[model samples]
Target: MTNDRRVIVHPDKPALASSVAARFLTKVVDLLDERPVVHIVLTGGSIANAVLEQVAQSSARDTIDWQRIHLWWGDERWVPLGDAERNEGQAHAALIDAIDIPEANVHAMPASDGGLTLDEAAEAYARELALHAPEGADTPVFDITFLGVGPDGHIASLFPHRSGIQVTDATVIPVRNSPKPPPERLSLTRPVLNASDRIWLVLAGADKASALGLALAGASRDEVPVAGIKGRRRTVFFVDREAAAEVPERLISPDY
Candidate 1:
């Protein structure tokens, strides 16, 4: 990993999730000590869900004020409100429902049945971001943004060689024809994601090795969307040995 980026390789998936959960709790607790509320952007995937579960099981989980935490999604499937495949739904099942966060504090992207067109939903989410954003900023300065990388090197809904990856003006946009299932989705644009103070990419599995390697090797954003992501303060990739298999030895740190 470069000076601006760091990689933490765990022995296995369970270990990776546990370590990330512990660090996440620490970060939230530390930030809450200095501020009234802490904002976080969450992602969806097997490993992402695993981390959430770990957080829920943590002994320190109750120390942080859940009601003072604001939750947001980095991306969401444009499905019905409670669809099984929807990221927001899965998140609620895995963590939200187990916590005390107020309904107003949970900012989920609009669902398809919300009486808004896909474009309209995107616009609405952008407006929401603008409303919560810090003064003089187009997006919120999230305390931390958690994301999961696709095997295709995509981050959020920005796929390689896609229009989402090329967009430069919008903070949120509607995505169509995603290489993965549920083609239609809503995702925060690169600028909005980069507005965060820190970004944590939680990844696992051998299938992701090639993409992880390419991203760490400085692949272009247009070719590897994950490569384009950088936080204002720090960017860290938490991966298990299987996922880090293809990354250079110099970039893989076992210290975590």
Candidate 2:
């Protein structure tokens, strides 16, 4: 959040997710209508899962050719494919399970069985993007990247006061000793995140108030990972009332 930017807050997580999903679908349809394919980077967490569920329930969902849509993860816990805790597994339960997206189009990071080291996984994901992305496209090449704001003001695996922010080369990196659980994880660095056409940050819960307030108050980038988002009009935040209670009235949406 910046002094010049506006925040869109809803009364609850469900409402926030539903509203954002509706808007996201419109963009998806427009992209497909103009091009042969659409690419998106997905994230994990409860709010994101809710958004995906809403997407699955949307009437316009079936209008898009699912097979023409390419999918990639913004981060992942280093675990077996389909493992209960894996972000890919959670996404499958929410949206992918209900869609006809092709297996080849869904690109996930190397699981434990991929026979690649953490560094290798990072390189492999980058190669995957290079193969499918349009010519001259930037690092990420994602049409839309969905993210979740952690209670600590972290986005993806970029934790506050952590070294993930300085990553410049590899779009993906293996994270060890994450302040959150599942220490061994892989995440999309800010370089890749900033290259996206659009970024939607979905945050909820009262526990996130202080961090949200700090983030919106122009906190230092190293202290609040959310500050890494450079929208220029391409970024938006979806927050529930409880999560925004600490924020000033001017920052909260009137509709909420």
Candidate 3:
């Protein structure tokens, strides 16, 4: 594992979500204390949704100024606005709607019903990022990004050996022929995701154990896209015991 990485294991899925939620809340509050606004990227999956639900139930959630918390999706299914498969939709139903977050601060990707082509939607999302990016940065320096690792080690829509993983110039790209269901999607490229100050990969279930192990063992990013993901300041993996089953002892933190 890389020197900047940390592995935190919880006894179960619920505990993993709760622990991550606590850390997430504290991180947001600390960032807001230093600035008026903080940008965050959200991911989708059972684990990610659970974390959002936990965040919604956090007692300290009131400490955050929801209006100053800008939300962005790390990747999104190219379906209609309210489709259950869409990450933004899941996030909204799980947490966003329960908070006082301003509508303008919620930057959801364009859906198929928006009358734009897949490439067009991807380009539009990239334009949105460029507009909100801090001065002199190609992409917004997200305060923290939450990602979920597929059982196959895919992160976002960047699946193993896929062309999407090779994209470096574009901030976001349209994904076609994805190995997973609902093949059509939009995802931020590696460079864009790696621009974040911190990254948290949330994983659970024994199905994810092997992939997580290979990723942390320094596998090729092209073969294991999640392996390439690292935050400028910190990269962390929050896994339940089931997911951590195959992780190397050296990568696992003794006290985390």
**When superposed on Cα atoms, how far off is each prediction in RMSD?**
1.5, 2.1, 1.3
Assess every candidate by TM-score: 0.97, 0.92, 0.97
Which digits, one per residue and each the tens of the lDDT, describe model 2 over residues 140-167? 3678888888888888888988899778
Considering TM-score, which of the candidate structures 2 and 3 is the better prediction for this target? 3
lDDT (tens digit, per residue) of candidate 3 on 1-256: 2359988999999999999999999989999999988999999998899999999998998889998999999999999988888999999988999999999899999999999999999999988998998888767779999999998899999999898988998999999999998989999999888888899999999999989999989999999899899998899999999999988888888866
Q: Looking at candidate 1, what is the lDDT of residue 74?
A: 94
The residue pairs found clashing in candidate 2 are none
Better of 1 and 2 by TM-score: 1
Predicted structure 3, TM vs. truth? 0.97
| Local accuracy of candidate 1 as per-residue lDDT tens digits, 1-256 | 1248889999999999999999999999999999988899999998999999999998899998998899999999999988998999989988899898899999999999999999999999999988988798887779999999999999999999998987889999999998998989999988888878899999999999999999989999999999999998999999998999988888766576
Count clashes in each candidate, considering only residues at least 3 apart in sequence or on different chains: 1, 0, 0
Arranged by TM-score with the best first, the candidates are 3, 1, 2
lDDT of 2 at 34: 86
List ranges where model 1 is wrong by over 4 Å: 1-3
